[model samples]
Target chain A: MPTCVGVGSPPVMAQPNNYMKPVGSDTRFGAVTRVRGRIDGDGNLVVEGAVEGNISLRGDLQLAVGSEVTADIEAQDVDIEGTLDGDVSASGQVHLGPGSRVRGALRASAIIIDDGARFAGRLECDFDMPAELEERRR
Target chain B: MASTVIGVGITIEGEITTEEDVVVHGTLRGKLETKEHVSVEQGAVVEADVTSNTLMLAGTLTGNVASGERVDLQSSAKLVGNVRTARITIADGAQFKGNVEMDV
Candidate 1:
């Protein structure tokens, strides 16, 4: 190891992958009164209370377990681990984690419905229908 | 870390009541009432009535404000509203247009 100065510099940050969670604040809407309005942002947002409106973001969104939300959402990535009753449009991927209950249409490039997630919505994802199946239908 | 933060690119069009600290680096239109300190960062826009224990504003505020502790308006703050606080400090470079009610 190299010799260091007397008063050393602060610790360097780890690699991006080493940071498991997103950067922005948790933005927790604590479990109390419902939040009503349109939320638009470029940072990652996590909701734990009740919300009724539209959530539009450029980064990511996570709904914690047991939380209730009634809002249409459009984001780069979305993780649902709670109760949602609105349409979700994700540009990247949408993950419905275990124990989540969701209702409404979902459109994303990729989607995951983990085991134990209760979903009642029209799921639309990018699909490549094989030519053989198309020929059979023709 | 504050429990709630309205991120830079976010905008809220309704009321926000929290029992914890709230940082606004985005936009809020309606009302904000908290039992803790609240900071409105520079470049943010708040057109709502604000109530907090301590209020620190460095952005554009266009509503009435009531704080229990104090209200500090930074140099970059542009406020156009009434203020009802126990204590208030207006930085030299700040722009304010409101009635101050220190009696409250």
Candidate 2:
């Protein structure tokens, strides 16, 4: 007969599978849907609809093609391929794809503007100039 | 799949207006107006007034509902709101506590 360990067994403690995993939630808003408020959460968000408020997320934010947004956004990272009319502040990278029309200030560690994207905003990024460029400025 | 899907971990606290179908699996606390069907799936919670063409509820709702076509409450639904629609059906095991107004 096999002996059964009681509740106070030494090796009975096990960590959950998601113990060290980041928040892996995802939210998607499809086309033809419109929202008029604020959204703040800890998950990735994909928007293919219209939003008229502020958005703050701890994960990536994607604004798909044909979507329209009129709100400020703050996220870990951002990818925009639609129309945005608000400021964007990201802790990570921010990319404005082709055909995207953005009209606001952008502050991110790294920013990329693709060809054919229309943007009218202030860019705030930190860069280290090379030695040759530093000599030219003297 | 519905045109609009609110995932299980998301929450919205405002107004939503859609021209296509909507499915909710999270929490919403505001107003919802749509031109198509709306489904509040299981584990979802909606505390808002909903106006839609039709509604299929299997979650919890605590507000008023106005549907143009019909409203169907599944067995797992728990609703506490007044309903005004052309047709309505409440299945067994469903809990509802509100007035139902239908056209004669």
Candidate 3:
């Protein structure tokens, strides 16, 4: 028999190169090729191409260099190393590396950005401390 | 298998939420939420609210962080915001400014 976990049990993190799949379909937004839709998966998403929709995943989302995305992205964590033209939201953390460029807003619990990285947008943070609250009383 | 890797020289602007771990070596703007770990490697730049079980920053982050386990700011890390988590670690060369609430 399989063990039962909590409803909101955290998912297991996969390798860094097994998230997103290539855009199998086509779109009219542009001829440059883009993905338009909600993405929910358990693997890594390596977007070497372009996406014109929102990406919602249960794992990590990585935008390779030279790649562009014109939609919102939601996942457990986010690692941007390419070009994004939208908003990003994560329950875990967000990372921005050098030479990376972004134009939009971001919301998450933790955020990390390297030097030489260009970004323009708003930021929102939400940190939960249930154990901390209990410790304060002691 | 739902983990995405944003290679170097890449840039993204939007919202990213997942249930697994994520690593960034580029630039990103927007929101990032996860149930696992989020690693912002060196040379990475991110501006958003990152939530996850654990967060490790070796790059630059400007925003808030809600970590269930802990938040580690490496020597090459820089962050500015209100961080709330069970534990927090700031390296000697790490730069951070904001309200920090630990489990203590």
Q: Which number leads on DockQ?
A: 1
**Global lDDT of model 2:** 0.84
Candidate 2 residue lDDT tens string, B1-104: 54787766568889999898888877889999999999998899999999999999999999999999999999999999999999999999999999999878
lDDT of each: 0.81, 0.84, 0.70
Ranking by DockQ: 1, 2, 3
Candidate 2 segments whose C-alpha is farther than 4 A from its true place:
A1-25, A126-138
**What's the ranking of the predictions by lDDT, best on top?**
2, 1, 3
Q: Which candidate is the best by TM-score?
A: 1
Worst lDDT window (10 residues) for model 2 chain B? B1-10
Candidate 3, residue B56: how far the Cα is off, in Å: 0.4
Q: Where is model 3 more than 4 Å wrong at Cα?
A: A1-138
1 or 3, greater by lDDT: 1
Interface RMS deviation of candidate 3 = 12.4
lDDT, model 3, position B35: 83
Residue pairs in clash, model 2: none
Once all C-alphas are superposed, what RMSD does model 3 give against the true structure?
23.6
